[model samples]
Target: MNPTAAILIIGDEILSGRTRDSNMHFLAQELARVGIDLCEARIVPDRMQAIVRAVRELSAAHDHLFTSGGIGPTHDDITADAVAEALGRPLSVREDARAILQAHYDRSGIPLNEARLRMARIPEGAELIENPVSAAPGFSVGNVHVMAGVPRIFEAMVASLLPRLTGGTPLLSQSLRILRGEGEIAGPLAALAADYPDLSFGSYPFQQDGAYGAHVVIRGADGARVGEAMTRLAALFPEDRAG
Candidate 1:
């Protein structure tokens, strides 16, 4: 089986539609690049109980769990606290995180207030994920990785941790856009998918300028098989190209 991952997004802002949750899609794409199959995603509010429950559940369900949001200096940022609660431990300021954050504050010449210091609090026995843009660190507890809520910081944290994660063979994808409707090629695509059961095939329909187009995407770990599938797909629709 492929190595699977799940993402948990914790924030009242996202739940209330105040902010669009972009972190899940970013993690999904990055995990795909690293050969980790992103199988599930959940977005919960900033409530402590909900955050704790989602973290615990996702951690147990997937090989890797990624969480974004609620780890900032604001009052609503309670991800660190919730993570500790989930693990049945008290949240404490981690020494390494504190040191890094202190240096950041010192360089900026801004006094590190208690609210900012809250960023140093991490779950017990967790490895820190470095944030290159901001020294506020993310952390890993067991299979769950806790990260920042801001899209920029969360993406940087993910990039930092990518090298440390061992992944399976990376997935390869091939796509062609056929000047036809999805209904016209759905049967053929399904048959091709069945022929190469190891691969996944998807057909997406789009309408533009009174014309119909279907984009067929074939993806799998085996490069040769993916190429072969693309060949068969092209044979099914000779006019299809990389539109």
Candidate 2:
């Protein structure tokens, strides 16, 4: 079985509609590519209690937990502190992380003010995840990896982090679009799904130009099995084509 992972998105902007979150979508795809099943995701405001509660629960529930946002320079960036509290670790500025931040700021002629120094407060005994986009650096505490919320920075951190974890076989999928509603094909789809217990069958409905249809997707870790299931599914619905 593939290792399962969860995401905790922390920021008031996401909850307040000031920001549209793309990190979760981006991380989901990246995790899938590495064969880690992204089983759950949660978004919470920039509150200490909320961040701490989610960090503890999600880290315990899945093989891996990734948090985005709340690790920046501002006062509201409390993820590092929350995660440390949740894990019962001391939260403080480490020299390594401070050096990274200081170097980046020095190069750009930016002063290392107290606000900027907040980014260096990492939890105890955590491994740092590289941030190529910015030098603040995300950290991995046990199973949980805390990263930046900005899409580009988050993606860079993911690229740096994925190499550290092992994954199972990537799921393969084939799709077919049928000119029929889900209700019309429910019975056949159910039967097909039953025929391939190891594979996953999904029917997503869509209406285009006033015509209703559904796209059926078959997925499995075994490519040959997924292909066989797709062939049978298409044969079951002879008029179907690729969507």
Candidate 3:
């Protein structure tokens, strides 16, 4: 079976709409590529209790839990502590992590102050995740992987991490754009989906330049099944075929 995953987005900025979350979508796509299903995503404030609660819940429910945000040097960066609390692990500054940060700052001719040192603290028994974009590293304790909220850093961390994980068959998808209202094709789409029970089908509606249409997507682990579903869907709406 494919490993199931959940995403925990921790930041008051995301909750307040001050910052839009791009990590969830990015992680979802990356996980899907490696055959891990992203079953749920939750946004929690920077509060420690809220972070701890979400960490506990998601960690228990999914095979893997990825968390973004709140691991910086700022005061609101309480993700490490909260994760420690949730997992019942002690938090401390590991010398190896501190050494990495120290060398990074020293090479850049910057002072590694107390605030900067905060980044070295990690949960007990966790493995450090390398950060190529930044010196400060993320850690993985149990099934939970803590990562930076910045889009670039998060993407880099995911790239480094996914290859080490055991993934099932990669999911394959095919899409066909139909220049017709979703309602017009709803019945046939449903019947097609029923006929291909092994595949998953979705219809996304769009209105462009005063024209309304839907983009139908077929997805499955089996490429032949997805292709067959796409062909059937195309046959059902030949007049509205896009390209």
Candidate 4:
């Protein structure tokens, strides 16, 4: 079975509509590419209780839990503390993490001030995730991986963390565009879905130039099975097929 995962987005800005979260989208795609099933996602404010509650719930439910945002140097960046509380782990500035941040700031000709040292505060027994883009590293305690909110830094941290994880067969997907409405195809698609219980099907409708159509997408762990299902789907709708 594929390893299951969840994403926890912790930030007040994201909840306030000031920041559009792109990490979930990126992490979902990347996790799927490596065969980790992203089963759930959530966005919570920077509140300690809210973040702590989500962290416990998601981490308990999934094999892996990735958190994005609220790990910056600002006072509102409370992900570390919340996660530490959630897991009953102590939060402190580790020498190793501090050394990394110190070296980074030193190279950039910036002083490692008190505010900047907050980046080094890690949850006990957590492993540091490398951030090539920025000096502050993300951390993994148990199944929960705490990452930065910035898109660039988050992506970098994911790249560094993903390879260390064990993955299953990559999920394969195939889509067939049909010039028919979802109502026109729902019955057959339902029947088809029943025929291949191992595969998952989706019908996304779209209107282009006043013509209604749907993109029938099939996804599965087995590439051959996915391809076969796509072929069957196309044959079932050959009359209204577009691509």
Candidate 5:
């Protein structure tokens, strides 16, 4: 099986739907490129107990657990502390992380205030994930990885961390969208999926120009199987096939 992974989005803002989640989609695409299958994702509020539960559950379920949000300088940012509780470890300031934070303070001429110092505290024994965009570093404790919540910064951190992970055979996907409704092709796509159990077939309906249609996406770890499934899918809608 491909190296399975999951994303844990830790924030009340996300669950409240005030913030649309882009990190999961970003991490999903990036991990897939590195051959890690993103199996599941969970979003939790900024509560300590909730965050702890999510971390423990998702970490146990997947080979890797990526958590975004709540690792900031504010009081509401408590992902690091909650993660420590989940792992039954102490949350302490690390010398390595302190050095980075201190240097950031020095360079910016900003005082190392208590609010800013909160960023230095990490779960014991966790390795730091560099934040090139910002000085605040992320950390990896066991299978659980914690990073910042801000979008641009979070994306940068994920790009840096993904390369260090070992991945499985990358899944390949191919897609086709026809000007026909999903109902028109559901039976054929289902047959293709059944014939190639290793391949994942999906049909998505869309509305365009006052017409309804479907987009068919086929996925499989094996390129040959994915191609065969696509060919069979296309054969079902001959007139819709483009040159």
Candidate 6:
């Protein structure tokens, strides 16, 4: 079976609308490309209890958990500690991580003070995730992979991490644009979905040039099944444009 994953976004800025989240969608798409199902996503404030609760719940329910935000050197960055607490592990500064940060800061002529050192505090038994964009690294504790919230850094970390994960068959998809309303196609789409229980069918309504239409998309792990479903859908709506 394909690995199941969940995302936990930790930040008060996201919750208060001060910052818009762009990491979840990126992670979801990347995970899907590697055949891991992104089953759930959640955002929580920078509270220890809330982060701990979310981490514990998602960690237990999914094969992998990817988290963004709250791993920085700032005061509100408590993801590492919360994860440690949730897993019943002690949070401490590892010399190896501290050395990496120290060398990076020394080369850049920045001070590696107490606040900067806080970035090296990892949970027991967690593995450090390489950060190419910045020297500060993310870590994977158990199944929870903690990452940065910055879009560029998150993307970079994912590029480094995904190749190491085990993936099943990649999902295949096809879309057909029909010049008909979703209401007109809903019944037939439902029937088609029931016929191919392994594939997923979705109808997305769109408006173009003051005309309403729908895009019927078929997605499945089996390319042949997806193509067959797409063909059946197109035959059902003969006038539609298949793309």
Please provide, for model 2 over 1-243, each residue's C-alpha lDDT reduced to its tens digit, 9 standing for 90 to 100. 999999999989998999999999999999889899999999999999999999999999999999999888888889999999999999999999999999999999999999999999998999999998889999999999999998899999999999999998787888889988789889989988998999999999999999888989888999999988888888887865645
**For model 6, how many clashes?**
0
Candidate 1 on 1-243: residue-level lDDT in tens? 668999999878887888888988888889888899998999998899998899889888899999998888989999889888887877898788899999999999999899999999987889999999999999988888999888999999999988998898889998899988888888888888989989989888898899888888899999999999898889878865545
- Residue-level lDDT of model 3, residues 1-243, one tens digit each, is 799999999999998999999999999999988999999999999999999999999999999999999899999999999999999999999999999999999999999999999999999999999999987999999999999999999899998888888888888999999999999989999999999888889999999999999999998999988988888889988888876
Worst ten in a row by lDDT for model 2: 234-243
Assess each prediction's global lDDT (C-alpha) against the native: 0.89, 0.92, 0.93, 0.94, 0.88, 0.91
- The true-versus-predicted C-alpha distance at residue 201 of model 4, in Å, is 1.0
lDDT: the better of candidates 4 and 5: 4
Model 5: lDDT to the true structure: 0.88
Give the residue spans of candidate 6 off by over 4 A. none
Candidate RMSDs in Å, in order, are 1.4, 1.0, 1.0, 0.9, 1.3, 1.1
Q: What would you estimate as the lDDT of candidate 3?
A: 0.93
Q: What lDDT score goes with residue 14 in model 2?
A: 91
Candidate 6 matches the true fold with a TM-score of 0.97
| Candidate 3: residue pairs that collide | none
- Work out the TM-score per prediction: 0.95, 0.98, 0.97, 0.98, 0.96, 0.97
In angstroms, give how far residue 232 of model 5 lies from its true place. Answer: 1.9
Candidate with more favorable, higher lDDT: 5 or 6: 6
